[model samples]
Target: MERERESVSAMFGAVPEAAGMARDVLREALEKWEVRKGADDAALVLTELVTNAIRHGTTISVRVVRERDDALRLEVADGSRDLPRPRTASTEDEDGRGMLIVTALALDWGVRPFLGGKTVFALLKVG
Candidate 1:
């Protein structure tokens, strides 16, 4: 397999503003990589990951890597060691739908554990 990759990584404090910054960074990175087809979905999924991190951790770092010609992998690492689980949201519920959206958009996703925290990742196939 031929490998062509570009990556963007940044650290953000746990705050509401981090989500928007992440989206902007992802948008610019995708544009630079010429992978605009799934930019909206990518931004949405990135927002959810960052938001979740801000809620549970003190500091977060997000990395988006263009894995190949058509695959992009997004990883959000946080100070918390907890892994996220997808849950079925109630009809009247306003939350718990983030991971569902991720599952629907990503080709595959998973979590990786490190010494002091964990990284949640989603892979999107965008040509």
Candidate 2:
């Protein structure tokens, strides 16, 4: 939370509550940044990203940056070497639809390799 005015970020433990916490932080950031568009989609994307991080990796950190006047980038970094893959889920499946939801909401999303792990980022236009 001590980051720049155009950005807000938080680190989270690998817990179930991490998704909710990240979503709250993301909503606050969107409001503070005066971003009206894609607020709900951004929160949904953030939740999926955080949940995936908690489920698949450790040392999770969520960051939101005001990329431009019409764009915001949501980033979730985790201690995982394996990148995310969108999988097909059936009607009776209990899980494994995170990336599908993310893909449906985000304008763009990708992964970046880091020293210890990787950072997954989703771009949302918040005009």
lDDT of each: 0.89, 0.87
**Candidate 2: misplaced stretches above 4 Å?**
1-5
State model 1's lDDT: 0.89
CA RMSD of each candidate after superposition: 1.5, 3.6
Candidate 1: list runs displaced more than 4 Å.
1-3
Q: After superposition, how far is residue 118 of candidate 1 from its true place, in Å?
A: 0.4
Clashes in predicted model 1: 0
Count clashing pairs, candidate 2: 0
* Model 1 per-residue lDDT tens digits across residues 70-125: 88899999989888888999999989998888888988889999999999999988
Leading candidate by lDDT = 1
Candidate 1: C-alpha RMSD to true structure equals: 1.5
lDDT of 2 by residue, 11-123 (tens): 99989999998988988887787778888888888988888889874879999998887788999999988899799999999988999998988889999989988999999
Residue 67 CA displacement from its true place in model 2, Å: 0.8
